[model samples]
Target: MKDQITIVGNIGSDPELRRLADGTPIASFRIASHERRYDQKTSSWVDGTPSWYDVSAFRSLGEHVLASVKRGQRVIVTGALTIRRWENGERSGTAAEIEATAVGHELRFGTTVYTASAPRREEPAPPPADAPDPEPVAAGAWAAPGAETPF
Candidate 1:
């Protein structure tokens, strides 16, 4: 089973958008998620250590994220989680990353206006230059053969 996680946090950096040689877009950003505990003695909320995660979104989702997300914005991200250990010149650390499946603003922080993207439609191929034009039909001639037109 794939490991998945959902996190609500503030974006730690601006989303970086890049295109691969194949023209596929990918966006990456950092998010800081932390816990807040209410202390009755202090009568206030105390913040815990922040956990950072790198987030990546691909294709149209990446494009949308590049257009919509910004640094310091509160957002919710859900995706597959991956942890990798890397070493460079004796320095080694585990990095956490998420391949985002869904991303959106955290509504509790503020209101956001949503705009739906229009479906992409491929243009019809042009007719061949040597192709003969079909004969024109009279108005209301769309009725099937032997069927009477309602108009």
Candidate 2:
């Protein structure tokens, strides 16, 4: 997989939390972003592309998003694009969605979220206190970012 993605927009709506038939928790929300263009004549703000995306987060991630994220809050979404189709008797429409893996408050955009009540991700148990540290390795032994390993 390429792991290719686009990101970082403000939330357009409140995240709605719900469950599936199998009882997995999930939340859905929308993020709206504006695209701008340079106008040589007016040299002013010109509205370009306005995109709205439907985002879904699962399990504890979903709950955290619902509890911490709010309308007009900025967020960065990273997930592969998915197309969902639904029907209701005589009408149907397709949805473009992103299954969010990570989300963060856009502090740069004046959105602040205190995650005191949000569920934290479970961390792996640390090694026993008696364990010794491994010797440090030389540089260039690990693969660079986005580069394949020699092994």
Candidate 3:
């Protein structure tokens, strides 16, 4: 699609907030996307090119973004690209922008990590006050990491 965009990058600086004429909120930041090249003989990775993107979040996302996100944090932003035209000192230029909607933390290269967020509260009743904590499970107790699954 012409408007589709997906970006994974490190935050360049803390997000800044602005207000529209009608009081709409706008949050803007710079993202630096990096790539690495691998050397077959050396079995090592070398630094590669990086592309910078300018992103913006609006409304509630904008209001909370500045406080929740920080510079240098790695994140994945999914949104659409909009080509905006504006005049700069009598000169016109096009700018690339992503109206971010879904933002997530990206896992490391070749590694899959799942995060469990805050637990929900049950309305019926709380757990027994004297209930003992669950036993600690050993790493090997569960399936081995990267183990093959037979279907």
lDDT by residue (tens digit), candidate 1, 1-151:
5599999999999999998999999999999999999999999999999999999999989999999989999999999999989999979999999999999999996998898797676787999999899677676675645446576
RMSD of 2: 8.3
Off by over 4 Å in 2: 1-4, 84-94, 111-151
Residue-by-residue lDDT tens digits, candidate 3, 1-151? 5497888888998899999999999889988888878989899998678777788999877766765677988888988888778898979977777889866666673333455444444566666999898676565543544444454
**By summed lDDT, which 10 consecutive residues of candidate 1 come out lowest?**
142-151
Candidate 2 clash pair list? none
TM-score of decoy 1: 0.79
On TM-score, who's better, 1 or 2?
A: 1
lDDT of all predictions:
0.93, 0.79, 0.78
Candidate 1 ranges beyond 4 A from true positions: 122-151
Would you estimate the TM-scores of all the predictions?
0.79, 0.63, 0.60
lDDT score for residue 80 of model 3:
84
What is candidate 2's lDDT per residue for 20-129, written digit by digit as tens? Answer: 99999999999876776788899887976767788889998898898888897777888777777989999998866788888778677575736555445568689899
Candidate 3, TM-score vs. the true structure? 0.60
Model 2 residue 96 distance off true place after TM-score fit, in angstroms: 1.0
Deviation in Å, model 3, residue 9 alpha carbon: 0.6
What is the TM-score (0 to 1) of candidate 2? 0.63
